[model samples]
Target: MSQDHDEALVRMVNQIAANLGPGREEADAAEGVCTHLEKFWARAMKRRIVACLDAPDGGLAPLARRGVERLAERQAD
Candidate 1:
């Protein structure tokens, strides 16, 4: 997808996160969702995301890589 689509999807994901439960704390809800995403996604798309991000070698890089892997996993499954 193009950058625009990517951004839109990100926004959509954020929105999905925000709308997870029926409550006034939508922002908080989204944050919780995003947090889960970070964990799951980090493991899911570990490689592609790191390459796309051009991340340097480091321990923190796995989070990004796994996030990308998660995206792929989501697509395939």
Candidate 2:
């Protein structure tokens, strides 16, 4: 992905994490992010995020990473 696209992706994920982080357990927040993304984001968007998970500097927050992982695991099932 282009640098701009990568940054935008990171920013979007971070925003989701932040929105869901308040007054919730970390695990719950992560799951919430996963559900939100799964329900709202396009399938291609989810695939792009999953593909970026291993990038050395993908710029995903910890919660975002967890959310993406959950999304991937669910997709695998």
Which structure among the candidates has the greatest TM-score?
2
Name every residue pair that clashes in candidate 2. none
Each candidate structure's count of clashing pairs: 15, 0
- Go through the candidates in order and give the C-alpha RMSD of each one to the true structure: 9.2, 1.2
Candidate 1 residue-wise lDDT, 10-33, digit = tens: 444445443553473644553455
Worst 10 residues of 2 by lDDT: 1-10
Per-residue accuracy of model 2 over 2-74 as CA lDDT, tens digit each: 7687678778988999899889999999999999999999887888888788799899999999998999899
Tell me the lDDT of model 1 at 25.
Answer: 62
All candidates: TM-score: 0.32, 0.91
Regions more than 4 Å wrong, model 1? 24-27, 43-77
